[model samples]
Target: MATFHHYPFCPQSRFIRLVLGEMGIAPATVEEKPWERSQSLLMINPAGHLPIFVEEQGLAVPGAAVIAEYLDETRGLGLDGRRLLPDHPADRVEVRRLMEWFLVKFFEEVSAYLVTEKIYKRFMKAELGGGPPDMAAIRAGRSNVRYHLQYIGFLIGKRNWLAGPDLTYADLAAAAHLSCVDYLGDVPWEEDETAKAWYARVKSRPSFRALLTDRVPGMAPAAHYEDLDF
Candidate 1:
């Protein structure tokens, strides 16, 4: 069996897990705290990142996009109507476009903030010295999240889903980050009916059930965290 080292409630970890589930591959799950490096993580990926994918062939894959594509290729997933990438070339371009948007732009503007403060706070130690999450940064993330929600609302209004006609990697990426925030009670679902409806669809996925069940030691989930209908 393949091995995966990751922390629960990690967006990148959740992203690959969902893809693995989609690919019909099961891995031996090992929980890893990435604040400090370990010999095993070093062996898996010299960079020592979370969400490490160790394949049956002993190939270690790092980064979510690369891992997603690798799993899709190896497991014959993300094809036809069931594809995780968009079918049309233009739409495929758009999928990559939004994939970067959520993974990079959203991460820089939003996920960095909330995840740092809420998720990484107690779990992190001062020796890491990246500095404790800035309250201003977290507050800004909360503000930016509202605007991001509005943008998602507008996008969803224009197209049924975040990427295009069918659900794709962008959808999962967006959900992955937002679920991290939503788990911290930071998402305002009431802001947009379309976004809310879209969320319910994302939440109801079989890939998402495990994420909803994740608990972070001292933190309890938000009121609607586990409610599929929410």
Candidate 2:
């Protein structure tokens, strides 16, 4: 058995959780607040990041991409054709590319602003720069998200999944970020019905149930956050 250290609202953490859920591996989880930079977390991952996966052998796999790849090599073998990383070289590259698009590019452009300002700030202490949400950042996030949604729609129009015909880490990564944005009511789902429909499909998966049930204390999810049909 492995142990997973994460923050519930963290998109990267959520992505790893979804991947583990898809693989049917339920590890014990420790909720972490990355902003705190707790010594315990630092000991395992000096980067002070969420989503650290610790193997039973005491090997600590820090970072979401590292954990995802570790799981693919160590646990995904049993999934056969259902492996989240496609076997073909080109397909594998596409999956990694989309993973980067969501986890890195999308996060930097949208989720980083919204999640940090709206959600994390609410829980952070004043000394740590916590206070009222930054409306400017929020507005920027809201405006930028429309473009990403349109991109999702464009991709879906040509492929069954974000990367290709089969579900992959690309979908999980994109859905992870969107789920966080959606939780904050920042995602403009109506702007792109294709993206909305694609999200609906991912949101309805068994692997997504845990995320749908997540509640962030003072901030409740949007009205339609958990609605399968929405």
Candidate 3:
């Protein structure tokens, strides 16, 4: 069996976890605090990032995008029609585009601020920059999330999923970020019914159940975080 090193609240980590679940790959998971910069973690990934994937052969794959692609190529290809990535060249491009949108753009604009301030900071040491949550950044995350939700609604209006007719990494990526924000009680779900509805569908997936159960040590998820209907 492979090993997965990750943090519960990290969106990128969550994305990989969802991908693994969807692909039916069960790896032993090790919770890691990137801020701690443990020597053991550094030995595997010098960058000391969370969500590293270690194969049974001791090969360490770091970074969320890289791990997602690696798993898709190694495991997903055998899943036939159930693969998260599309088969057509154009469709694959769109899937990658939306994956980037959520993993990078959405994370930078929304999740990074909220999770870092509200969740991660609490667990970090003062010397490592942990302290009271930054209200300004939190406000920015709260405001920015509304726009992203609107974008999701717009996309869902046109296609069954974020990238197209089938569920793909795009949907997983978006859901992973939103799940983090939702946990912080920062998402304005009422402001975008379409997005909320789309999210409900994603939330109900078996692959998503584990994420809903994630609980930060000192923080509780939003009341509706685990409600599939919400």
Best by TM-score: 2
Q: Write the per-residue lDDT of candidate 2 for residues 1-230, one digit (tens) a residue.
A: 88999998999999999898888899999999977889999999998888899998999999999998999998884233498998999999999999999888999999989999988999889999899999999999999999999999999999999999988999999999999999989898988999999999999989999999899997789999999997
Q: Write the per-residue lDDT of candidate 3 for residues 1-230, one digit (tens) a residue.
A: 99999998999999999898888888999999877989999999998877899999999999889998899888874233577987789998999998999988999999999999998889889999999999999999999999999999999999999999888999999999999999989999999999999999989988899999989887778998899887
Compared with the true structure, all predictions reach lDDT values of: 0.80, 0.92, 0.90
lDDT of 3 at 171: 93
Better of 2 and 3 by TM-score: 2
TM-score of each: 0.92, 0.97, 0.96
- Overlapping backbone residue pairs in candidate 2 total 0
Highest lDDT, which number? 2
Q: What is candidate 1's CA lDDT for residue 5?
A: 81
TM-score of 1: 0.92
